[model samples]
Target chain A: MTNETETEQTPEHVPMMQQILDNPFLLLFLGVTIPTVLYILWGVMEVASIPLAD
Target chain B: MTAETVVGVGRRAAAADFRTCPYTGLKVDAAAQTLIKANAVAAVVFLLIGGLMGLLVALTRWPAVHLLPADWFYLVLTGHGANVLLFWIIFFEIAVLYFASAVLLNCRLPAPKFAWLGFALMVVGAIITNVVVLQGESSVMFTSYPPMMAKPNFYLGLILFAVGALIGCAIFFATLAIAKQERTYEGSIPLVTFGALTAAIIAVFTIASGAIILIPTWLWSLGLIGEIDPLMYKVVWWAMGHSSQQINVSAHVSIWYMVGALLLGAKPLSEKVSRTAFFLYILFLQLASAHHLLAEPGLTASWKIVNTSYMMYLAVLGSMIHGLTVPGSIEAAQRKNGYDKGVFEWLRKAPWGNPAFAGMFLSLVMFGFIGGISGVVLGTEQLNVLMHNTIYVPGHFHGTVVTGTTLAFMAGTYLVLPLIFQREIVWPKLAKIQPYLFGIGAAGISLFMMGAGTLGVARRHWDITFSDAELSFAHSAGAFLMMGLNGVFAILAALGGAIYVLVVVGTVLFGKKITAGHKLTFPLHAGGGAAVSQYGSHATTKLPGTIVLVAIFFVCFVLYYFINWKYLSELWLFR
Candidate 1:
């Protein structure tokens, strides 16, 4: 069978994304990245995250 | 010719019987071959030089041995660092650029003359800077931190080299544009080309940042401008330096995909997934560069925290996604095709015996597990103090740069050599062993040095201790042991490099000359049609003596390090 049909048929698997809610490895990676992401998000939410001062 | 004749001519030209195998697209004119050969030679020379420098640094850090003289130590260190890290890897990238655009995409480089000009300028620039550093005119490390100045020529050479690289990138994009306008490929670019194109795009931005910083710095050096801001220059420099590094990372990852596809016939697990990973690099790589400045005094707490923590996390996510996708694709391919039923079926069924496949595999594993882990930890804000400018930094990069990027390039060379040169390798056995020796050695050294760095070992020094401070004898002993082990690895790598040189040289000079139409086959295999499928087509009979000479020059570079060490030992001894 051609690659196109196989790709179309295969179901999506978001194992990491799913596991991020629970799995230790996933959580550890997420725990580190999430806080940083949120911190950046917090600043961006206030204004653009540029310049030294708020 | 009539319009009909013109159409017919176009079709025939398109269908021209080039002797390159279907996989590698190595078929090209002598002129193109000359350009590619020149780039490859420069790349290999830089790779060996870089790898040797890496080994020396590792030796000093790992076993805490003072392998060279105290006075000239930092100068050699900086030269070694810049030559190998920036020069070697990027030269290979240029070679890759030539291959991807001209050969792989089946399009002539839009301006071959400009490309040659770029290459010439880079060579001249690199040589000047390298020579200046060797003479102890400057030892600013690879970063070339200003305030701690070098000769004016050093900065000028750096700017010229970067400008030349910019021209090469411009050529790459122009070629791509022409290919698109001319409708070179049937549909979307083949996966490899697509990946390379992404790398090229990243390179455009990366080089721009480099130029922005380096050009200003050069002017400042000449006193053409007064008072350049060191902080601002550093920030901008990282924009280039970090992004250029990302280009390597992105290209290496793409090569992982290619290696998987070509060697194991593995398809990307999810095409969209892989593409997304490449895209994430474009988004996150530049931002992540801020992590390099985490421990610096001037940067605000908020700035450092956000850049190191937040930006780095996103970068890590991109890397993690890729870490999953590359192997996933290979696994999916192996499983889908019904390879074997062992517990570790994928591993068991994999063509582990094939040097190209094995080398690619080891490179991927090393980069992902070792390099990836170190990257995350070092990028963390608190962890930066422990690792920054320490032996760990070099250790971490060696895992990625030498073992990861260089190994993939070597594997690609092995697969493409016959198609490019139309000659069988002189020593396939030794050729296969080279990557393993190099990769294992690199990993050992990186691991050992990282351990040393954790114990607070400084980098770019002839001694482990700070002046007037008592040294940790136990830590120093561990560092020495690692360095001694690294020396062994270096010797192995050199041996592997020797075999590669011999193979290329023998193939070019004395191997039985075969014509373009000759069917290529692996000596050991016959009926499987697998080996033949990969290499049998696109054989061309051509004298590659010049190419072989270029290869020899690179080999000699590795030899030079050892010879230099012999003399350098008289000045300073590890013992």
Candidate 2:
């Protein structure tokens, strides 16, 4: 519980994963964005794989 | 922050004041409790309706009974799916979201009026859909795949429901904000709440996908638009359908954690790892919606493989982590309580007599061994061909949804009765036996369905016997027997479900009221002191018993997964 706004401060070490986990909003962004990209890619690949009709 | 200074001293909202629960010493907001009560009661009503519809569907599938005619069978099946899969689960999950956010956090809910509006819309939508289904104009089945369009009201009803649920999710997020801004509690939220948050996040995406697909489909149904491509419908539709089930997984898993802490004062062996697993779910869980698309053409193998495996099954890795940690936490708790004699003593000495514990434990085993293993098999692109559109599909979900998620919900309902509803369980003796009755019957339904499926039982077909066909087709004797057994199991499961409804409704209606001074149904309840310190440094706690159980699970998973491949290979080999 180090103070960041104070003039003299002692910072605590936090792991990157813990930082992400601690912030639900960050995790929410990744959760939604990642899946949306994957889904679009899946749809795009399917459309691309289709042969042009004669 | 003393929960008074950072937050207003009192009267945030007209209904925002909190009363501390006598059992747990947690502050319960009046508005939030009312909403929880409303949503939970609605969930039970829908469960009764859906469970009965399921019984009818099962009986019709049984071949021996063949209860309903074709039209009615499809109608009831759709109702069963909509009511149980969508309505019952989502309504309860709304209650869960509120409970997890406000009740668990000891904060006042921000918008009680909006929450009620959401609950009202859900109820209205569910009723509208059920009415539409029963009117015999909409038998499009649960999938309601495009081109086989139902009445426009059916789609309309579903849209209303999704909108309502989305509102519920909004209220939940807002409540979380209020908690944070008010400084209700310090540090990270509890694991149970984290798990609920995961469910809520996925739920938003799922309901949005539903809105995207259903709104257009509804317009199409009304002749207001052009044709909907079947393939496109399947893709977007399962984004909603499959992801909705993912919400269930997250919610029920949260309940499992809550129950563990409540019952045994259990703490997770590794909070970091468990939270990481939930994070993995958020990232990759919805991508597994591709499992349904595996059998469809025009989708490339790369797309199929990448998505269905959830990017190397990272989502599955999430579930596996939960599977280990939930019970491991309980084991660790038991050890702390001096049940450390051997590998099995913790499990052995745990309260099996407690319906909540028994049902949750059964749900864990069945979900992992049967549901988890079967799901991976079904998810495999190559192997899915063997079981695609077969009874095996339903079999797999029954393992997960019914035996796993639904059973977990029922188990948690016991706690809800004692804690939230403030009622002692009626027929305490019957309550004790309910979990086993339900668990075994559900396990039977899953197994028998899979057996019948392996012998090539069609999923949505009206009759397996083909009595009126031009060329009379016959399933093997074993398949016939398995369907018969499925019917038997359905009755058993119905009895189990009936017992639940009877006891719960009876308890809610007629049971003695708890005034907090009285002992709870579980006299030994730890009163939630365990939740305060839910994480441990001991990620590597020795649990040889759990190791052996996990080994057996891995073995079963490997064996069953390959056997499907073996069956698939048999299909291609030319003699």
Candidate 3:
């Protein structure tokens, strides 16, 4: 039974190389740039200043 | 699919040898496998002991209910808290160190013998300490705050363990040096390895402080030295304790990123943002330890104000930044899925059913809301008088440490186990359930504990309200709530923990072998592929990105220390 299930769900070895190439900008913005900016903001900001602002 | 089915699929793709890589000297040897297995086993044993100790302490405080004999209760509580929080966690940290340095770095350990020696020393120290405490001779609380001394062995045992840990840290550094000299990889260290390296840096400072404080305490215990200044020792001790806590925090944040990436096929919300947060921790975490001593005497008002108001603000900002980035990464991942639009669309469409993801998410939220809030409040010099040394402090940490950090580690372990060990987990079903049960139970305990803490309930005691019975009826109500909730939570968490233990045990011992080269399938949202390009272009460039970040942090460190030094000179010396 286990063998049947194993054979049934063989993982597709889809190389992400092409997708990465297609949308390079979106990838860069989400993965690298944003985190970098956030880090700068965090270093500068004072915690007591952030209002609940709800 | 069941373990059997997974194994079958893996068998077809299995590399000729699962234990070794021909190209790289990474992966465990058959003998090394035994050591790694032993480390994991020891970690779980300590976890159970710690959990039980927590239970005793929690039960005793719940409405002042004394389950154990009053005489022996405090002793058990102290041992339990120290062993669980420090010993168990450090043991796990060593396991993580091994994984990051060797397994993740794709290199063999430089000195396996020293690594084993470190483990042995730590174990011997822990055993001696536990034995002494259980014999009812050493009742000093977790901090074993001097002036209230424990038996000689207890302090000696602690110092030995810390020394062993220092050796372990040394081995980690040695391993990294070898990797660099050998040019283990063409480009930068992997992100997980980078995070672990940062943690190792923090541990260096942490253990140095520990040696300074503990060695002196050891001498004092043996009558070999005159009185160590209690106030100075307090300051130095917290330098170790609090900074060590930050190491856990930084490590957990890294694990959070890993868990999200591995489980959900998510990219960091932003690599730069996450890396920046990691750097901020190195800058701000050490200074913030002074917040713990706000209510203590002999510190000038200006010192307390600067430490509490300025430094804690930076630390809080670091946490808040992470608070935003962690969720933002998840949201970006969900957005990639193109889920239906709603106010809570991201929350609704999230893979809530995946225990690993859910557990990680909840842990982050609880840490931010409960732990972070309590931390800010308690760190206030004025507020410290109300909450210092109270149940609230422990509650805050439990929320952060147990929920935020340990849960993430456990979740990551479940995901990584099959890949690391090359053995199928014994009970996949139980593995899935364990995180939620433990997280929920822990969160419940934290909530009750915080409530009690707000009432100025003292921690590190069997019965909270001493003599005068300053606790109001409402306070008593909160205590009962804490006790009852924690009791239920403890059982649930233990049950879940037991299942995890069984799964780990079975995998190491009785579980069937799996074929090598088995790749775990991570579901990709549309944006998942985007991260590959992002990381490849920015982070994967050949200049050692992590080392560059560390260097940048050191520059900031110099500036920070210079400023603090000037301030200290003016306040203490010139004044």
| Top model number, DockQ | 2
Please list all clashing residue pairs in model 2, or write none if there are none. none
lDDT of each: 0.62, 0.85, 0.63
List of chain B TM-scores, one per candidate:
0.82, 0.96, 0.82
lDDT string for model 1 (B286-341, tens) is 56677777766656677667766776666667777766666655665565557545
lDDT of 3 by residue, B1-575 (tens): 01000001121112212355321223443433444555666777887787777777666655445677676678778877777677877777777766666554444566677878888988988888888888876887777777877788888788778887877777777666655555444334444555666676667667777787888898888888877766666777876787777777777776676666555455655555565566556555666677777776556556567666786677677777677666665555555556536535766767666656777777787777667666676676765666678877888888877887778767666644554565666666776677778888888878777766665566766654454456543346656566567667766766666676677777677755655544333222333222321242122222232233335534554564355345445545543
DockQ of predictions, in order shown: 0.04, 0.45, 0.02
After superposition, candidate 1 runs with Cα above 4 Å error: A1-54, B1-32, B56-65, B335-338, B465-480, B483-575
How does each model score on TM-score? 0.77, 0.95, 0.76
Best by TM-score: 2
Candidate 3 lDDT score at position B136: 79
Measured by lDDT, the strongest candidate is 2
Clashes of each: 15, 0, 6
Superposed on the true chain A, the predicted chain A of model 3 yields a TM-score of 0.32
Q: Could you give the CAPRI-style class of model 1? A: incorrect
In model 2, the Cα lDDT at residue B369 comes to: 82
- For candidate 1, the TM-score is 0.77
